[model samples]
Target: MTSPRMIQIASGKGGVGKTWLSVTLAEALAAMHRDVLLFDGDLGLANVDVHLGLVPTLDLGSVIAGRARIEEAITTYEIPSVSGAAGGVKFDVLAGKSGSGVLSALTRTEIAGIARALSRLSERYAHVVIDLAAGLDQSVMALCTPDSTTLVVVTDEPTSLTDAYAFIKLLTLQDAEADIRVIVNFANDREHAWRTHAALTNACKTFLGIAPPLAGFVPRDNLVRDAIRRQTPILFRHPQAKASEAVRKLARDLLVPLPKSTPGPVLRRGA
Candidate 1:
């Protein structure tokens, strides 16, 4: 039997480079010879294509609207390998819909279908990275219902901090048993990043009574802004940037083997 691939990238607040990190991480894993799929689960502000600077030929909106097939909506892009000296394989990006059609496509039944479909895809691919919305919602639940790894991105700013705490609060209520991985983005340095991670982890322990694991941090680099202005991802535009370097290290950290893959207990899905 094959395992399902689901990892969600999100933040408590907006503009903390959640989407950016998700895209780059997916690319990094692909470089390591892992098949990956980056799904833009954010309906309110779907822009994975913008980060890659490629206008998706089709999006989930079209697929749900019967205008496109799941396969037809997938766009393939090249991501550099971790070796830096070698090239990486391609990743299929599933962009989300922008209009009212987003709600119409994912009924309770459709979500179930999506879960099954993603598993089949995961069997063939190595990693499937999902970019979820900022907060809890219909789409977020549907996509995250299958998540095995979760990365919560945040910044040192007050709003981001408060939002990160609120996000974990909602997760506790929804998926209390889920593994929460925290990522602090746009930090001044390691110290600032640790503070943000510590704050969130401490809150999870205090409120939810569980200490969340710190995934890692991404440094604040002006090159990210410049890359965005150029309509390209920093990983591709400025591979040497601090943010890029951080993500590459993170890619190996996540992809590299840990103690072992003890099967996390299974939760049977009901019809």
Candidate 2:
């Protein structure tokens, strides 16, 4: 497998602003003029495109059903410039299949196909961020599993902490080689965020026998809520806001990371 730039955004619980973070990162990258693509691998509750107010022109549904190839389904969105990356970036994305429908766990063949398609996209985009579904599922594991940089977003809440621990435990059971980036959202302050992160790390180290580091945290700000309500990104709404700054840092870290061997070519459903 040839390596390509692969990024996975995930969380232990829903409603932790995971989608918001994913879209924000992608939007920020686009603003910076970096070739970017955000894939919605959260098939069960696809909202990445919805958050952007985009219709499901092409979705993983079509790709899975043989109606379309995954690459052919990618949609290019023009980022309204507030300006982000100085190096230059532009990008597009492919939305995942959204349904109550259960995704039959992909066989090795299906996994290979999905990986191949993603690798091709990576070759084109400087960064590809995938928004994975919340919690433990075969889909989540396959979409966010070790081969890519897996970013798990959390918050300072009992529920969030519990789920974050759960996720680390699950990841440890399955695989530990992933570049696990833990982000604490809605942080009251840096200290608050670090405390939450410390708890998670302690659990991982004490119980899971693994080391997953805190990537960063987005300060709790009204800008995030307001932007979503305004149907604009917070990074756009308040370019200088704390949340925007946090996202910028994350985008930079992701943009130039050591590349992974490109994923294999996607295979069409075989007879």
Candidate 3:
């Protein structure tokens, strides 16, 4: 069996629409008839469920506490038909708990256990999207792995740029060869996005000796806000929105076609 391509979406600062992009990207890929698994790595402040307007009784915290198996903590969302498809898309979501410092309090053993469980789950899907917590905390850095693709989401603000650089610097120190990508969010236009990407790419090249390529940019659109308020993904609620179109294009460009599964044992829960 082939392993899933794990993409970790991280932001140096909070409220930069990391969760929104993660969920929307998952929807976009699932719409392409690719199996996807969305993991809310924002641990204590998991907002993926809120963005999807779902109230999950179990989350990653539950599994970490040994109250439920990893499979039991997984939730499913039936994406309504789009593109005139006859059937809907089915994707798995592993939610996060909402409690102050709940995730931060987890021990190293507990964190490693979760990572191992995620690795096991990845085998069943073509892509695994992990919405990691913001900043350069140990908890956030612990999730970085050689096999995972890390996306650093940044905005036009100076603070956002500085903090994003700090996060990338810290990550490279740990794994210099890590597969990293950049996504400029809230850009005014293509030129604006290019400027922001250039600034970040140049700094990394000069200082860290590494430059992650720009995957794409997501424009500042009002439809994104509306979808958030209504607990719907813009990709599903308004596919015509500029932000949604960009996300769909980005997913298509970044995610590769799944390799043919070899003749071997594979475990799929809730298939």
Candidate 4:
């Protein structure tokens, strides 16, 4: 089987729905019967567990500290059915240590060891969704590789746009051929989303000489907040919500079809 496609979901700023998109995309893929691994890549302060309302017994810290194997710490997330059926979509989640500021102090070798381990583990799944830390920092860049897809999430806020630009610029510096994609969150409508994407792309084309495609947009929706409050995925709790529909569509658009002779995984990024 082909190795899983690694997707790094990142944002220029926090609170732009980076983790939200990452976990939901993983769920969407799992709902489609794709084996996926949703890794919480934010080492400093892991929030995937918090958002999902899961209390992970272990996290990346366990793997890095040699206390647990990568597979040992994985938590399972099952999509509940309305009728409480036996079969439902399920996926694996590797959470991050909550309040582990020391993770940020990890040496390069330690980080590389984790990356290699994750790379090896990814071969077992079709998609590996990584929720990277916010900003264009070393923690974010460490997960990036020639084969990885970087999804940069942005908003209409001025700081969000500027930070998104900086993140993309840093990726270019690291790997000019990096596959960067954009997802405009909190957009008022399709027009606003396209406008935001165009502005960012035009700026990159003028200065950095790299223009990543606008993968899609997630319109503003209160259901997203409600789902977060309940620690449930909007996709599962409110599939008909505007935000949920948008994410489902985005997930489908990003999932590239593989040839029967050589099937490959689907990965996505924003920026």
Candidate 5:
């Protein structure tokens, strides 16, 4: 069996719609008939459950504390059919404990154990999308592996671009061959999106000598805020929304098969 394709959605700062993208992206992949597991890697302030309106009894914290097995902590989410589509989409989620700094305080070895567990869990799914916490922190870095496709979410704001550059630079320093890509969120238009991507790419090419391609861009839409407010995935609530269509296109683009050979996990150091 082909190993699951690991995808890590990351960002330099908060409030860039990283979590929203993660949730909708997972749903989009599921809509495409791929079995996906959306793991909330944001250990400290996890809210994937909140975004999806899920009240999971067991979470990653339970698994980490040995109170529950990793598989037992998974909560399945289903989206019923809308717009005459056939069977609706379904995906699994491994939620994180919110308002508790305990998981964030885990040592490197403990993080490694979680990583190994995720590696084992990957065997049963076609894709595993990890929503990493914002900023350059130990928890975020430890979960990033060289084999995963890292999508750095950025906007046109100056701080967003600067922090994203710092993140890509640091990740490159850690793994020179890291598969880094960019996603421009809240873009005003296609021109604006390309401009944002070029700015970040120019900075990386000039300073880091590497230009990560733009995987895709999500346009700014008021409906997106509405979906989030309702605690429903935009793709299901507003399938025809511009942002939803963009994410669906992204899912189709990423559906291209990866290489046959799989690499062993290479977890990065927190420090």
Candidate 6:
């Protein structure tokens, strides 16, 4: 079977809407009839379940503790249709335990094991969208493979840009040819988003001799906040919202054909 395309969503700092993008992007892909799995890769402080308001009995923690198989940790989330419209999109989610730091305390070998498991799990789906933990920690970097496309989410804040540069720099050091892309979140408009992307791209070009192209951008929208508060995806709660529209456009862009390549082996490093 053809391996699923792995899309890793990462950010330099937290609160840049990385998790939200991950959820909505997966939903958008599912809406397009592609099989998708939203893997919560934030082992230390996972909130993907919280964002979706899911209370799974088994989670990644269960897999790490040997209480459950990796497959057993997956939970299917289906959006409810409104007014008896066609059934809403359905996708699978591999939730992570929130609050408990047990998964975070795992050794490097254990982390690599989970990474390998994820790579194997990709065979069953068309796409695997991993929402990585914020920052450039060892565990976070270990999950990043050169074969996958990494979407580094950034905002206009100075700190956000600096931290993004740091994360990109590390990736470049690890693999100069890594497929890294940028996504501008909470931008005022397209022009503003491009400007933000330019700032980061220019720095990368000058310092690292590489400029990761912009995958897309999401404009600031009030409905996004409402969806998060309600523990629902904006695409379902307000499909016509500005942010939802932007995300759908981004998802469409991603569907375009690209050169196929074999996935590299999972990165194995000590934590």
Model 3 root mean square deviation, Cα atoms = 7.3
For all candidates in order, the CA lDDT equals 0.72, 0.73, 0.81, 0.82, 0.86, 0.86
Which candidate number would show the highest TM-score if scored against the true structure? Answer: 6
Query: How do all models score by TM-score?
Result: 0.84, 0.83, 0.89, 0.90, 0.91, 0.92
Per-residue lDDT of model 5, residues 13-118, tens digit only: 8889999999999999998889999999998889999998899999999998899999999999887554445346799999999768789899878887788899
Q: Ranking by TM-score, best first?
A: 6, 5, 4, 3, 1, 2
TM-score, candidate number 1: 0.84
Residue 107, model 4, lDDT: 68
Q: Model 1: per-residue lDDT, tens digit, 186-214?
A: 78887777777788767777877876666
lDDT of each residue in 157-202, candidate 4, tens digit only? 8888889999999888988767788999999988889888888888
Q: Per-residue CA lDDT of candidate 2, range 114-210, in tens?
A: 8677876687776788888898776676665456777889987888878878876777667756567688899898778878888887877788776
Q: Which has the better TM-score: candidate 2, or candidate 5?
A: 5
What does the lDDT read for residue 249 in candidate 1? Answer: 75
Report the lDDT tens digits of candidate 3 across residue range 149-258: 78889998888888899999998888876677888999998878878888987998899887777778899999999988987667777879999998987887765443
Worst 10 residues of 2 by lDDT: 262-271
Residue 166 shift from truth in candidate 3, angstroms: 1.0
- In model 2, the Cα lDDT at residue 76 comes to 73
